[model samples]
Target: MSLGRYVGRRLAITVPVLVGVTALTFSFVHLLPGDAVDAIVGFRDVSAETEAAIRAEYHLDQPVWDQYLLWLRDAITLEFGESPVTGRDVSATIGRRLPATLALGGAAWLLALAIGIPAGIVTAVSAGKPADEVGRLAALAGIATPNFWLGLILLFVFSVRLGWFRVLPPDAPLVSLATVKFLVLPTITLGTAAAALVMRLLRSSMRRELDAPYVTAARARGLPERTVILKHVLRNAFLPVVTVAGLQLAFLVDGAVVVEGIFSWPGMGRLLVRSILRRDYPVIQAIVLVIGIAIVLANLLVDIIYAILDPRIRY
Candidate 1:
């Protein structure tokens, strides 16, 4: 199929997936222990009429199916209603916090690629040596470590003992050095596991490519070792790494929730945790829908990249 046709087909497939995400999110969020009204009036004595009015105002009094239909209708237009707890437009709130999350995720992604690709190349070239063994062990440890624990350890060591960075992230604009300084620990914490995964996969891919007949032909032609590896083996081995990096977007989102919370970063992940706790239905639903859309778009981008990298790949 043509690229346009393929993209259109994939996007069409996403529509129902998105709808299911909305329906499931709405149902599960409502099934939580308390409504927004209860969160708003917590531990306070209110008249029965006042409580009933609050429920009616927020449409919490509606049946679950009715609420889902109403929400789905507005959501189709990208009109997530106001947060019952904060009374702010859900889109505007998410817009404000989105940049921080993007910045964090982007930095972590770059760091992962920078570290992983080179490490993978080194390990593959030096297979069965001490360097490869050490790299493998380090990757295993990185994958095993928890994000929150790593964040705390980095915070304690760098921020508290060494005095290298702050315990809490600064309130600075995204482009500034202050923001970069603040992001260092959280980015490392969030990206380490992903980096490890990429390294292992790439190493394996490259090793397989190195043993291929074409690589043997290139070597027998008296090409330089560096040229044979870089110009031939690495290119073929890179496709799987691209696939993993695309899927890591979802992992980054999930890890950001804990990493942001640990560092007290004011991003959508932190907002999500807070909203869930307070039963902020609109905010919760909107954030989840946005995340779903992001994952779909990432997968689409991955498919496009696959075709670009390997012309043999078909729609």
Candidate 2:
């Protein structure tokens, strides 16, 4: 089968999976115990007339299934309704906040690539040396430190005593891109574990590839050590690396919440978290659905990329 058909097949599977996710998310969020009006108003003395008006205003008196269909339809048209807390369009709120998350996620991805690949290569080459030990220790630290704890430590040390950066200076204007600077600490915190995982995966894969029959044959046939390692070993080794990286990106979406909150970086993770705390079903379901779709789409894209990278892969 061809790449096009393979991609189509992936999409065919992803669409229904996303629909199921959306439906489940909607149902469960609304199922959470409490009156939506009381949850929003925080008053025990809400009048029946006021409650009825609120229900009519948001069309909440409709059947749960009807409410879901209405919401799904509006979402398809990019409407997304208004936030109960802020009284702003949900889509608009997400639009305003998305760039902040992307900025952090992007920074984290670059940092992971920069630190991980070279460390993996060096560790693989150095096998049992001091460099390899250092690489192992770095990975250990990265793996052990939770993002929330790491962020707090960094904030305490760097922002508190050392005065390197402030604790997320009050929502700066979105135009200047200074938000990148604010998000740096959180990004590094978030990416540390990912970088470490990638390093280990690559290091192990590279070590195995270097010792494989083909590499041994190439070396026996007069290939330089450097050429054999770089040209032959690393290339084949990267197929697994690509898979790991794609999985890391998917994990990053949900995993970003702790870092997002610590840094006050506006993103879907933060939005979902806040919505859950407030029991805001619409916002929660919407964000969860978006995240689910994004992960499936990303995996599909990765598979397509794999085919493009090596045409030996067939549908």
Question: At residue 216, what lDDT does model 1 achieve?
Answer: 90
Prediction 1 TM-score vs. true? 0.83
The most accurate candidate by lDDT is 1
User: Worst ten-residue run, lDDT, model 2?
Assistant: 169-178
Say what the RMSD of model 2 is.
3.1
Could you tell me how far off, in angstroms, the CA of residue 143 lies in candidate 2 after the best superposition? 1.3
Model 2 C-alpha lDDT per residue in residues 1-315, reported as the tens digit of each score:
887887788778887887787687667756777777776676577888999998898788999889889877887886777777777788887776666676678779878988999999999999999999999999989988888999999998998898877787446775555655666688788789889988999999998888789998998999998898888898788878889788767755553787888877777687877877876656766677667767777787778778866778766
Best by TM-score: 2
**Which residue runs of candidate 2 sit more than 4 Å off their true CA positions?**
30-67, 174-177, 309-312
Candidate 2 clashes between residue pairs 3 or more apart in a chain or in different chains: none
lDDT of 1 by residue, 157-255 (tens): 998999999888777778889888989999999889888989999999999999999999998999999999998999899999998899877545533
CA lDDT scores, all candidates in order: 0.84, 0.79
* TM-score, cand. 2: 0.84
